[model samples]
Target chain A: MIILGVDPGLTRCGVGVVEAGASRRLSFIHVDVVRSDPHESQDLRLLKIYRGLCTKLDEFIPDAVSIERVFAQANRNTVLGTAQAAGVAMLAAAQRGIPVALHTPTEAKLAITGNGQAQKIQVERMVTRILNLNTMPTPADAADALALAICHALRPSGALQGGEREQHLTQAQRQWAEATRKANRGGNMLHRGM
Target chain B: MIILGVDPGLTRCGVGVVEAGASRRLSFIHVDVVRSDPHESQDLRLLKIYRGLCTKLDEFIPDAVSIERVFAQANRNTVLGTAQAAGVAMLAAAQRGIPVALHTPTEAKLAITGNGQAQKIQVERMVTRILNLNTMPTPADAADALALAICHALRPSGALQGGEREQHLTQAQRQWAEATRKANRGGNMLHRGM
Candidate 1:
């Protein structure tokens, strides 16, 4: 199954596409950033981000999209921009009929580093190791996007396939299970998108 | 010129289109709501809104689009949804080449009721009076949408043309000036967005 991870922001958005095999082995497919100038009008900036994601979706055609969900208590300007960018990412995915999931910051950090409050560099190192890359992704946002995709792919409930009927999966576990089922379906490529 | 005002929220997005004569006469052209169910996933809800507004813009083809800029200090859930909805609204306008203007909530209230902190009923009553409508627009969001269009139309700097340029026009004043000039050129219906 293919997963596209999105780290959304107005000034710079990071995106990564990765393929996970039936054996759960992962391979990096693509990584890039979409940037909008800070001095541009809000309309132009938003359109750039929206159009960039739409183009990426058309190019990569990932089975599922994983987006970062930000906390609202951050610096107001950053949070507002991030939220809007996230909306555009979700819009692009939904318009194309791709299944989408949101991973909170803590959920992502916890899944990747086994610690909710792990530092950025630590998370980046883990993403590099998991993807089996010799050099880390250039920008931090790009590596973060890779981490989100890995979190979606390898999280516990999804990983523990044969152990069904637990009836007590954590929220994260439930998300992983549902997301895995949805992506694993991976409908025919010839008849994709609305 | 025709102005389409947007009150951005995922659950209930309000839209109002008004015709403002060079004589400064205001007439209601259209008023409606775009709604999304809360129980649905965020992507689906946002896509519904984005599609609905795109349909509205295509139908109305207004000369300009006006949007409400929300403050970040509001409830986290509501604020996040509002910001994303606002981004979608802007994207619709930008995609169609329509000039877009952002109005603060306080600016809308003050423009309509002469008080930034005016009560909802007060603003609704004033919108009814100004538009010469037989009754107030239903739902406070609809009324607020009308007020945003009116704020974009009748604000101080845009309305105070040919008046001496003070040594220092406030930032809002400058924006009103630029937005008015761009909207006023008001190219033929064939070409439009900013």
Candidate 2:
């Protein structure tokens, strides 16, 4: 199963594509940041972001699109722009009739680094190690996008609305779930197999 | 000049089209509320609103699009959806290369009723009088939209970015400005003519 993850922002939107193989092994397909000029008018900026996402959607054609859920409680200045960016991402996915899922930042962190409150560097490191990339995904937004894709790919069948949910854990997924349990023994952070 | 005004919302988006003639005379072209099912997914709802706005932009072929500017300081529960709706409105207009202008509710109220804090009914009454309409625009949203259009039409040349700005105030605009000054003697709430 292939998944497209979006870390939405007005000035810089991060996108990552990932594919899941048997036993839940993951491979990276693509990653990039969609940037728009901050000096441009709001309408023009939104149009650029929307068009960029539409192009990505057409090129990747992923099975599911995952976006980081933004909250109003975030920074008052950036929340509006963030929400607008996410809206365009959802619109792009919906235009193509692709299923879109929203995952919180915490969920992405927990799935990646086995710590809901993991620092950005930690999450980045885990994403690098999990995907076996020689170089880290530069910029925190890019790493966050990959984490969202990984989180959605590893989610249990019941947690998802109507998408593919692997029944068995691949060796790599098992190791990650074990790592999560090892990191938080008292907490119930186990994946489905565990 | 023809102007399309949008009072954006997730469930019920209000739209109004107005034409500006010589002497700043305003004629109502059309007004309606575009609604989406709340139970539907966010993406689909946004798509419906986007498509609805696109249709209006195409049908009316307005020279300018005016939208009520939403603030993040507004209702927490509805602010996100409202921003998303506004985003779609801007997107639709930008896609067609239509100039878009944002008017705050306070600005609309001041322009329509000479009172920034004017109540809904007062603004509605003033809108009816300004347009010489036999009936009041039903639903506060619809009236608010018309007020936005009127505000854009009556705006001074200096205030607008690149759209046509009338050098002289129409008779109706003069009366409205006079009324505004009369309503608040101590306030400098004058339109360009005053």
- Model 1: per-residue Cα lDDT over B97-128, one tens digit each: 99988876666776777766778898899999
lDDT of each: 0.80, 0.79
lDDT of 2 by residue, B78-122 (tens): 777888899999899999999988766766776777666789889
Q: Tens digit of lDDT per residue, candidate 2, span A1-194?
A: 99999999998999999999998899999899998987788889999999988998899999999998776667666777888899999899998999988767766776776676789998898899989999999777788889899988876544223224334544444444544334334221111111
**Candidate 2, superposed: residue stretches over 4 Å from native:** A159-194, B159-194
* All candidates: DockQ: 0.32, 0.30
**lDDT for model 2, on a 0 to 1 scale?**
0.79
Model 1 clash pairs are B97-B192, B97-B193, B98-B193
Interface root mean square deviation for model 2, in Å?
Answer: 10.2
| Interface root-mean-square deviation, candidate 1 | 11.1
| Model 1 ranges with Cα > 4 A deviation | A158-194, B158-194
